[model samples]
Target: MIRKLAFLIILVGLGFAGVGGWQLWHGSVKQHETMKKAQALTVTKKDPVKYKDWDPIKGETIGILYIPRLDKKLGIVEGTSPDQLEKGVGHYKSSALPGKNDQVVLSGHRDTVFRHFGEIQKGDDISVDLPYGTYTYVVDHMKIVDKDDRTIIHSTKPKEELVLTTCYPFSYIGDAPKRYIIYAYPKKK
Candidate 1:
């Protein structure tokens, strides 16, 4: 009877591990596909492309986010839905686009696309490459706020800014109660 109980426990543990592994693998595959689509939208012309007057639908690939300090590039999707975030970083739909002279907010899972988010420091460079143009921002500051904070998303109208958010306590195993926020401003030309 004891042997049977041990076997059942071990089996359950393995089952959990298998499910976790599958989730990670699936998210990675989706992100890879999203990156490919975003890359295809890259504009290589000598002249810069103008920003379009249209908004992306949920789950749409909008652009690519480049973190120079981490040597990482991630796809930027349209919304923050679970399906969209599973693909890559999710861009808040109501936020302004690159070069829009307003605020742009982006969020990603701490364990996935933003695993190295804590490594980013002030003065680091983050750039977004969209079909229209490439805009670069320099990290200015960072803060830790409650997960329920609503002020994190606000208007920076007339001035362009970028905000990157991820769950705090990067090592936490479950939903973190705090948020790590990084504030960046346009890089001087």
Candidate 2:
């Protein structure tokens, strides 16, 4: 009976390892493909005349978020719905887009696409490549707030800003109640 139990334990452990390995493999492949697609697409800034009128379809890729420190580049989709997020970072439709001179908020799943987010440090540079231009923001600070925090949406006037958010407690297994917010500003020439 002892030997049988040990064998069963070993098999269960192997099964768990196999599942983890597959997840890692699949994630890597998906990321590689996203990067490739983003690289192939040429982005130009939105025309000023139509900037305010611009609207995107829910799952459409709107921009690319590139973090120099993390060496991560992810496509930014138009909406924050589950389907959009599953592909990459999702841009909050209600917020301004890149170069709007207000809050441009983005969100991603910490466990997958934004897993390296915790490695970002103040002064790191983040670039948002839009269809018409590429805008870069220098990291200012990071803060943790309740998931329902409303202050994050308040506008910071006269400055082009970027806010990237992910669930807090990066490694937590269950639904996280806090948010990890990274604030950055336009990189000065």
Pick by lDDT: which candidate is best? 1
For model 2, how does the per-residue alpha-carbon lDDT over 18-86 read when each residue is reduced to its tens digit?
998997677667556655666655344456566566687787777689888888889877888876776
lDDT of 1 at 145: 98
**C-alpha TM-scores of all predictions:** 0.96, 0.80
Inter-residue clash pairs, candidate 2 = 43-131, 44-131, 44-132, 45-131, 45-132, 45-133
Could you tell me the lDDT of residue 147 within candidate 1? Answer: 96
Looking at model 1, the pairs that clash are: none
lDDT of each: 0.93, 0.83
Candidate 2 — worst ten consecutive residues by lDDT sum?
Answer: 39-48
